[model samples]
Target: MEPPELRRAVAAGRVAASELGLQVDDVVVVHNSDRVALRLVPCDVLARVAPVGHLADSEFEVEVARRLNAVDAPVAELDPRVEPRVFLRDAFAISLWTYYEPAESEIAPTDCADAFLRLHAALRHIDLEAPHFTDRVAVALGEVNDRERSPDLPESDRELLSGTLSGLSATISTEHDRDQLLHGEPHPGNLLNTRRGLLFVDLATCCRGPIEFDLAHAPEEVGDHYKGADPVLIHRCRALNWAMFSAWRWRRADQMPDRDRWRATGLDNVRAALDRCHLD
Candidate 1:
């Protein structure tokens, strides 16, 4: 039951690879969600395919990866056989990256933290144009405020999400002096345990923010392992993250699996996080 977009994406990815003179006989879907990621068969290259409108975002990810690779950051590398740039074909944007075989062992919390620390350390010295974390909050807020985007969301829930996003964004912005380049979402799903060690993928969400903001996306235990992270700021950022995720889940266009369950869970997490914040 592949979505129509996924079918188109697979075709676009294969065509893009062939145009680059690479022989891709089959395409294996590595991941499919908001975007489609295909592994070009026989070639062992990962091709991330999205709509044409995401061309700029894909290009941004390629540039970010290039810079991070130069600094030897713990991030995935762009495919070397092809030009290190995005390819557009059949109304989709495609970017090729090195395919890493997954390691059997799960990444420990300490290992995840160490990877994040290394990534952040490298990111600190690299200069790149990226949005601030508040911009992401604003996008979520826009989704909450737009009835068409979240038609199924109750008014009360909408108000709660809007308030949480706005309040936390303002509070977080006040600490902009501590801001630095951050992996906007370092959650477990974005971390890959490979023979090369824990390498991060999906760099499109990179932004300028406090390190606490990135830690909020990781496991709670990870924060304890990351030195110098402010617990209070992490808590607030966690709540904000939940709100943003909830807003995304509520969107009519969101195609995440088990949307109803994730939407409910996200809302519940946001409420619980808010309660804990209030109690503290």
Candidate 2:
């Protein structure tokens, strides 16, 4: 959705929440992309609104977070008063979560590693159906191939992206590495260092994949703290993540707040990944 449309949808979501008895005094946008995150004050709720088609994914995230909370895992929790259900308003789907105050200092690598181990243990026991991590790669591959949709991407870069994705997809598919429930994007940005402890916020991207996939987004020092994690697989997953994000940025550059900067950085990301994987 366009920026104007997104803002309107989020505003509508806030209004819907108000109707539902949420005391929302102010709405501060935490992030905006395929999903819009609003920090609702007074009542202290975080509203996540995505496109209608993403209702299932949003609901799934709430369910996953609630279940993880049940097991005393370090994860963001949903609002207890409101039942976990998708709130449809306008063209968006919204879900409410209990908001946490950000910690004054960033969480250390060791803290992140320890928290992830606990979260991973809880996630593995979840029986809900989830897509493989590579399925997202497949979607990115499709977007990169849509020249009409991503007209800004040069033909040279397009060919490079296609070839790079194909190789990574094959490698990811045939790897003998053990698979497990992954946080999907366990980078520091998604992690909140609350007063309670380190809690993960974005659950929409959770999926079944190698633990190394989760570590790929973390700092190398953080990966080192994760005992028994394969360094080689972590290296490969890092490359895969770059490829995925590169394709996504290339596809959505026009809608981005800083299109030129994103494109330049995304091109660099793709080039670096290819060189690292020896695919260049």
lDDT of 1 by residue, 164-247 (tens): 999989988896569999989888888999999999999999999999999999989999999998988899999999999999
- Candidate 2 lDDT, 158-277, residue by residue in tens: 887777777776787687457777778877788888988888988878887888889988888888999999887777778778777777777744455666787778778778766766
Per-model TM-score on C-alpha atoms: 0.96, 0.93
Which is the leading candidate under TM-score? Answer: 1
Collision count for each candidate, in order: 0, 0
lDDT of 1: 0.91
TM-score of model 1 vs. true structure? 0.96
- Which residue pairs show collisions in model 1? none
* Candidate 2 segments whose C-alpha is farther than 4 A from its true place: 1-3, 252-254
